[model samples]
Target: MTDSAHIASGHATRPIGGGGGKIFGFPLRGFGLVSSLLLSFASALFTFCVTTMVAIFALLIYRANGHAAVDMAISYRDFGFPASLVVLAIALPLFLTLWIRAKIMG
Candidate 1:
């Protein structure tokens, strides 16, 4: 069959995807199964990491200063870890809930 014949058949094919799935509005297309599974978590994890870095930088500058900053920087390095995770945990559900509501509304 020529290209024109294939096109005329009206059976335009979809590129192979990562099998069957849709998390939120994102289709699990062109990704591996593991990547598809992790896609949902990726946003939350990115949010958490960025928040942690910002918090650490802010705390270091505003709260910790000079000699105190050095000491606190080392001792309280993990301080932002729990705080950011908690924030992410709380925010993620809220995000998903709002996302679902918006999807439904549309």
Candidate 2:
């Protein structure tokens, strides 16, 4: 069928072939890898910092409650790094899914 017939019938076929992919009017093909990495890493870093701070604070409170010297290393070893890894895992897939869906459905 002709393109005009599809349009007249109130049905329009979308172009799926990737050609200069863009989403929300912003160029994405060229930046998809960089953007995805940046977004995921940023999320992980933020989670690490915040969790580390909270861990340290909790350790300080523990020390104040008469605990034998709390090890600051536990903040990174036991809490922050693991939380960051989990965040990175979650954020990377979430970002990639949204990115791919946008590119395909756009």
Best-matching candidate per TM-score: 2
TM per prediction: 0.38, 0.68
Give the 10-residue window scoring lowest on summed lDDT in candidate 2: 22-31
Weakest ten-residue segment in model 1 by summed lDDT = 67-76
lDDT of each: 0.55, 0.83
Tens digits of per-residue lDDT for model 2 on 1-106? Answer: 8888998999987554346556577554433756888978998999999999999999999999998997799999999999999999998987787678767766
Residues 1-106 of candidate 1: C-alpha lDDT, one tens digit per residue:
6666777897555444334355676553344334433544665566656766776676678655653444445323565556556655775564555455445543
Q: Count clashing pairs, candidate 1.
A: 0
Cα TM-score of candidate 1: 0.38
In model 2, the runs with Cα more than 4 Å from the true position are 1-31
